[model samples]
Target: MVIYFTNQTGNTTDASVSSFTSIPVLDYTQALSPTTKPKFLAQLRDALINVGFLYLQNPPVSVATQDALTQKGFELFRQPLEKKLEIEMVNSPHFLGYSRLGAEITALKSDHREQFDFATELPAPGPDEPLYRNICGPNQWPDETAIPGFRQATEEYLSEVDALSASFTALIAESLDLPPTAMDGVFDEPQQHKLKLIKYPLPPSDQTSDGAGFQGVGAHKDSGFLTFLLQATPHRGLEVQNKAGEWVSAPPLPNTFVVNIGRALEALTGGVCTATTHRVSLRQEYFIDADGKPLGPRYSFPVFQGVSMDLSAENITLVVPDHIRDLVKDDKVKSDAEATFNKMFKTSIGEGTLVARVTSHQDVGQRWYPDILAKALQGQKDFVSKQ
Candidate 1:
């Protein structure tokens, strides 16, 4: 159960200070059965409202496909350093390519993980289009000869998960007491989605004095509508923050994806759905061998479900029932300064998305969007000074 407290500003804070142990688990197969759909919806509603995270069992993607995709990840990262650098993220104006370990920053600190970012392959926008239109572009792929079947496997997995995420989103709409098609308008003809293949390496000995080293990915909310994460290793690293400001462990479970709501959904839903902050803090033991030597890196794959770039708060008209709206605190989920820049009403989805990309991957910004990057950096500096 969740507990909430109201501040003097009249905004409610979750304050879920109880022994909130485990993330709720929901079975996807049950959602397909007429007899069990109600129960599934009830469980989903609670998970969406309170935790904003859950373990999804028996999703559309099969275990074999999952294994294939992960195997490709291992192969991709195993390529020689020079070969990996061939498609480095700096080469892509769209920010779609490989990012070296500690190359990406979050919350002003370098994240200690190497990752490859890609999205639904789309052509670059025309020159006369809006600058945010640049976000849609082709990806930098590795040599097919070096990694046989890598592209095929990844594309297949992406296609399967894309369908799954869309169907699941419809279920989310139903759980919110809205028509299943309530969110249909927030998507474009060719929806834009993104995926990441991440590797969190073992921390150096000197950095592990406190047992935990640098952050794998810093504490932040996803900018999309939903995120389906496949934790491809046994190591425990991912953690979710509760309303009480406590970090709860979210370890890998067999044949299940750890799904979470994202900031985009929270904005479109008018705060009816929550988007909790989460981070990955790497522990030495998580990547240590029995002999105390370094083990292999921890791997994970997360697919971010996208929304229409044209969407903005001023145009959003999805109505939340009064009773459901009452369950949420005064439509103020987070009071942080960054939230201001991320709010849909403050900026269009495309602009907000571009700012986040430019800020996180500065190399892409410097190479492709210098002007916007300067403003973004100054804004961040201004926010930090105020804090």
Candidate 2:
């Protein structure tokens, strides 16, 4: 199926397979400026309420900083296989570390990407702590001897991303007409912030030339609060699914980060803001390099932002603004935030995160926490049965 995407500039581009009509590309600099704040907020509100995904141009980080980090990331990934495998993700109980190509699954299919997942450098929880606490621990790192500047560069970049994420979160709250600190509690202490350095190679030669085939990541929704994605390649393959189920290409643009809402945000706002589904796939046309050689690989940095594991501890209540609430009152939206919270608040944030991870990483789930995975899967069945 040929899909047409009309960008913010009204320029239409055609894709051989499914794609969206358009996705918003907003100015992050304007959103942060006091003089342009109101207009920026309005545009952001509209994008969130309608599309759930946006390209944030001119993010707070500097080009030099980004370049340095990207270099370090490339260095880490280019290390000898023996060196890179030292901190394999399977070795960690918290599921933080390296995952080789085809190691992680999406929708039951293996994703053709390799990545290193890092989180906040927090210590292990006490034995008396909750099960979710087990998910928070020190990140696995490569030896400084092998990759000289990798750790420092990554940690610095993570700090910048966290700050940028917080700024966006504030803007998101303001867009909803809520207090700037409204969602602060979710990120107070021991916050769950994950950074992944991912690389996607060209699909197998025998695969169809048509865009219908999956090349890298599969179609999936983010499970946390928000995501900040930095693409290092020129190929366009990140696709966002619209309400009509059509996928829209979100090609990589220089100096911009792709930001999107996640399930937690959707549940919090009663779906007033979208938590759209998206995926990654490199098409055949982008398979060759500038010199006509097979494309080396595609790299991306994605940060997954999550709230405190005990999000239900305070019995958080969401009072959606009348104006916004009325827009999605009908069942046009997939899940009603208020209704969902009223019914599933007990295990929403923590269990939701667990279910998302376990379902996606079958090997990790089976090896690490089989009991918890079993309970979570059963809970999923119960939830589905009710629906």
Number of the top candidate by TM-score?
1
- Cα lDDT of model 2 by residue, 62-121, tens digit: 787789889989998898888888998878877888888898877657888999999878
Best by lDDT: 1
lDDT value for model 1: 0.82
Instruction: Name the regions of candidate 1 deviating beyond 4 angstroms.
Output: 1-19, 208-213, 288-295, 329-342
Model 1 Cα displacement at 175 (Å)? 0.4
Q: Provide TM-scores for the models.
A: 0.91, 0.89
**lDDT, candidate 1, residue 289?**
55
Where does candidate 2 clash, by residue pair? 19-247, 20-247, 20-248, 270-337
Instruction: Please provide the root mean square deviation of candidate 2 (C-alpha atoms, Å).
Output: 4.4
Residue 338 Cα positional deviation in candidate 2, in Å, after optimal superposition: 5.2
lDDT of 2 at 372: 71
